[model samples]
Target: MRFAPLSLLISLSLLSFSAVSQDTNTVTAIENDITLKQADFDSFTEILNKHLKDESQQQHQLDLLRARSTKLEKEKNQALDAMNALYRRLIEDPSLDISDTKLRYQNAVDSHKTNKEDIAMQLASISAHRKDIEKIRIDRHALLNTLEGLKEQKNTARVERLRNEFNRDGTLEIQNTINCKRTETLAACEQRGQHLGMQKATKRFLDQVFANLTEIRLVEPKRNSAGARVQVLNSHVVNSGFSGHGNYDVNLSVTMRGDANNSRLCHLLNLDNRFCSEYSSSFQSIYSPQQSSNFTGNVRFSDPVTVSTTYPEIEKKSQTYNKPVVNILNEPEIDYTHELTLRSNVHDDEVFIDGVSYGSTRLSVQLPVGIHDIEIRKLGYNTFKKIINLSKAQTLKARLVKNKSHLVSKPIVETQISNISVPGMVVIPAGSFEMGDITGNGLANEQPVTKKILSDSFDMNAKEVSVSQYNSFAVETNYVTEAESGKGCAYYLNGEPVWEPSLNWKNPGYEQEDDFPVVCLTYNDAKAYADWLSSTTNNEFRLPNEVEWEYAARAGTTTDYSWSNDIGSNQANCGWCGSEWSNKSSSPVGSFSANQFGLYDMVGNVWEWTQKTAGQSDVAVRGGAWNFAPSLARASTRLILSTDFRANYIGFRLVKER
Candidate 1:
């Protein structure tokens, strides 16, 4: 959104063309092309953090104010108690120091005034602190946004030179498979990334995605009956592994014992899988019941790393069938050849049809009803080629004639295809839960509880949307909030809701971190942001319906509060809680532990807007805010406000439709 002057390091790196070496120039040139410039990026982060508006300082000041308010209230109460006691003594004695008693009473009244003045000044300072923090946050976002422009700079001369070098380099893409061996940690391997694929040789599951990829980095390259060596020839980082930690591409290769068909592809620390030991791995592997010369395989990946949508669970039909024998009573006259399958006795062998390599030994391909040429080859083995006429769905077994004389190695290749599930969303598995307030102690609106079923699973952001996230949306859309243009957000002033022009998501009438949920957004404002997000990400994101919101908030608990029935202090932000933030404003989301569903701030921080419309013009808001009493902060508590209403205590979370 905003540009910052280039840092001294960046400026120096850009200038002094004659003094800078060609290699230095080359590094600077490609820095624009890479996603990470480790050193420069790290330096920039340090600078940003150093200058970051520390909202916590303001929060600390607010805490002190609350403590001061409590202490003053106690002193005032004590003085009044002393005055009352003295008056009682004098009445009993029928003669006493009435002057002293009167003085005590007057002093108590004066103490009350002083307390009020002190608290007012404290509140004012807290507000100023909030303003300061927001400004710092604005600067922080603007600085971070500038990184894209900085990284997008291009030098035509350097780019051309780099391209020329890439063309001249013969060892760019190593077709052979490689393993990481014992080096599991990226740091341990000097940050060398082994472009891993399934190394499992057994064609247990033949899916086209895996079939198309040259190297299959298996879940367990060593455990598929023939624990082969997890071997990496060399770790290649454009230059070499030793120097390859930065943002650049590299090439590598690998091999192991046993038929490659039996192994699932994976990267090892360049150790022969046979020589390396097995460790805890992830994801299920597709197993082929029968190993055929023609392999039918399916593709799958280890978990934590997401599988791409392009590679759907389409099971490539590479099944091997015994040639049908003529049966007059049961068998059809002729099996029309429509689907064709080809396999190799050896794994990772190149299979070619019409001169184009299918990329692996065992492959399934659809052929028109006609004759075709198939070729299968592996290095150190004889090349296999054959011509076959197809009349029906037929499976062809290509026994590669061993190239006992050829010294060529097998090469497998597949094209590369590129969440929040962002970093914080958690998948709430599809399940039916009885919806509504189980405890009847809640509001009448939570009445008429019903048993509802969620037909489909959905994802919910673990934490409420933060200020930084909302800022990005606002910047991209050039959007303004209802509060900014309307009556402004309703904030507490002298113990009453008052519209303040300074009150906004950026200020939120309190000091808060970027991690704090953004507030003062109306229902329409929230919806507009949701629509923009859906258009941008092509994912259905919306405010949760009241029913879904309560279900997630309850997280399978029937308690009044998300944690349990008893109104516990420090569990949420509310007026009744004598916590540090009590009767002040929202805290950062997840300040307290999350509920059973791993959702943070489900019951407090702010009353989240739900999709449920109330009456004729209002929108439903749930989970009370910092200013509300604990009773209203319960999961079952329901409050509705006009569609135009925006307050420092109103915000919303996200639910992605699945």
Candidate 2:
């Protein structure tokens, strides 16, 4: 064989040394990685064990707290039963005035309250412990998974080392086989075959190791049960009365249990949980248990008063008056009747003779010729009373004084003739006016602007009825508004009307003073009010007919509005009427200039109910409201609504026959 060159021999030696060094470094690095991962796995395993031990301890504590809570609840119930028995015995036999027994009952009540508080505290503690246990279990599970991943990494590193070793040995064997010329030895061929077999076996082992790591799965933590208990206490109504025009005052005891979610109670009042919690805690600390606290405040009602002893929460309500008990004695009958005419400075003041309504003032009635007690009453005015002995036909006049405390507005100028002028009313002269859309640009309903004629004069309310006026009728007659009796009134929200069950005339989604025109009235409600007024005033009080309403609204004007063809500023309260209360709320009656006929709020403030019907079960509504646009507020505009439909934008004005 030819002698190899020195340079070639040196190159071969250097290449072999480089390959061995590379293999050695790879194996050493993989071994170091396995060592570090093994150490981390061991450390994490220890931490997971510690977390598991803590979780076990917390679970045990939770169990103990639950048991204690149950015991306290049982004891509290027993104490309550004992107190109830003692109370019943005392009530059954009032003769027994045993001080010792009373003391025992008081002690039992105190004990019950103490037990309730303890139970609450125990439950709170248990809840906290359960949370801690859940956290610990979660951490422990994560740690276990991390340990398994670290162990797998360690195994993978070892397999990588084995692969490196096989590569190095196979490379050496291949080199030796290349160096052995055409005539290869048996020993070299056997070594090459053995290296190939070893490489395939190592590859299979590494693949198996990866498969085992991929198959590892972690278990999820179990969920815990959550619950709470609620208990209501007995309540008693102490005092109640009509406190204001549309509100009442009720002094009562309210008791709320602690450690319970009272969201349901808050929902009943259409309030949030935070408000409920604050209200409940106002009586006593939530940490303290059952304690009866006295609550005294004005309770405004939109519905009938139905007080419950179990729960004394504030509800929209109206005052209920109890009829006075009367005792009649046998007496001789006097059978002589005479004509008696009643008159008052306030023309329509309600008159009562001998405690019976005899219609309004400027009224003629037949009364027995004897001593009679007479009383004249009007809203926003003091009552006028007198005792009269009438033997013949005579006119009795009483001057009513304005009640300063409940004054709604400056006294309206009274008409000169008491025989023809009614209080809060204006006499419209018989005339003809162009009804419907007098302006060329109006809706289809306003079309066919025809000439409407009124053959006879009629009296119409100068201004829409105020809250104070309606409240008087409601209080006297105990009439429940349709909005209050049914679902509720339609209140505007998000640029549209929404049915708000909690809103009514008393609370129409905004604050209203006594003088503000009453809204949230259905056609039936207006009819009922008119009927009541007629019965009390001895006049045919009813909603104005369509032709009459349009004629009155036009006020002898052929323009779109009473002032002009265009909606003038400060002329009315509407969406764009340029009034301060426009689009926000209904203004007080007479807040703006009146129409030509001296009638206020005929075109705005609130839609007026009319006697005319539009479609089946639909009644006609005239004018417009503060929440409506100027176009809707035009004198000729007309809208029809269901008889039972009520909203904050709807009200009424009455008309009396002349």
Q: Go through the candidates in order and give the clash count of each.
A: 83, 4
**On a 0 to 100 scale, what is the lDDT of residue 626 in model 1?**
77
Query: For each candidate, what TM-score against the reference?
Result: 0.36, 0.37
lDDT of 2 at 25: 67
- Candidate 1 segments exceeding 4 Å error: 1-423, 613-616
Q: Each prediction's Cα RMSD?
A: 26.0, 46.0
Candidate closest to the true structure, highest TM-score: 2
Where does the lowest 10-residue lDDT sum fall in candidate 1? Answer: 1-10
> Where does candidate 2 stray beyond 4 Å?
1-423, 614-616
lDDT (10s digit) by residue, model 2, range 1-658: 1111111000113443455456556546656755665575466556645655765676566566667657656765666676667678879898766566556656655765665676577667655654554444334323332333343333333333322221221111011111222454433323222222222222322222222221112100100000011111212233433323322233332221212222122232222222222222111111111112221111111111122222123323332222110101122222234788888898666676544445677889865444666878765566798988877888887899876641123334644232333348777878887888767756555789788778888888888877887887898789999889889998766444668998899999888998898889888888888887777767799999899888888776688876556554555787655668877999999876566566888878999888955534446788888877666777877765557778888888888898
The lDDT of model 1 is 0.52
Candidate 2: worst 10 consecutive residues by lDDT? 219-228
